[model samples]
Target: MVVGSDGYPLPMARFFPNLAIALSRETFARIDAAETVTNLLSA
Candidate 1:
């Protein structure tokens, strides 16, 4: 389901933890090891 799916990992979050969130927005989610917005969920 990723455009550039080969650009990141997949263990960063519980894939589709909620159908509402997964399909609500444009679903701009991805896993980058550069430490980007990884902590946004906790904040």
Candidate 2:
């Protein structure tokens, strides 16, 4: 979760839904790619 200057969670979904969605998608994509690579190398 993104933190605000006030030390609270940023209302990203409410104020910047597009950005929030994009960030989540990118994060998941990276994680999935990393996992795939790790599995391939382990095998």
Candidate 3:
């Protein structure tokens, strides 16, 4: 449901920032250990 400035659909990778935060939280949601993780967004 996301689009670019040109009105074209944006790829999933374009959501890296949101994805990274959601993923990291979900990854440790049920675990006791939490660690900082970095996500690199590249074309």
Candidate 4:
């Protein structure tokens, strides 16, 4: 379970920088492959 500020645990952002980094890597990889851009165009 995650808490917020004011003496609370952050949901993910604070406690999961590595997860964020992994997600970012995947996102960038997809972007570099033009997957995201293609989806944007299809939308």
Of the two candidates 1 and 2, the one with more favorable TM-score, higher being better, is 2
**Candidate 4: lDDT of 20?**
94
Model 2 misplacement above 4 A: 1-15
Tens-place lDDT per residue, model 1, 1-43, is 3333687656533565576676544344444433456667656
lDDT of 3: 0.67
TM-score attained by model 1: 0.18
Each model's total of backbone clashes: 0, 0, 0, 1
The regions of model 3 sitting more than 4 angstroms off are: 1-15, 33-43
Model 2 accuracy (lDDT, Cα): 0.90
Q: After superposition, which runs of candidate 4 have C-alpha atoms over 4 Å from their true positions?
A: 1-7, 35-43
lDDT of 2 by residue, 9-43 (tens): 97657678899889899999999999999999999
Best TM-score goes to which candidate? Answer: 2
**TM-score for all predictions?**
0.18, 0.62, 0.35, 0.48
Candidate 2's TM-score reads 0.62
lDDT per residue as tens, model 3, 1-43: 7898899998766777888888888877735333222222321
Which candidate would rank higher by lDDT, 1 or 2?
2
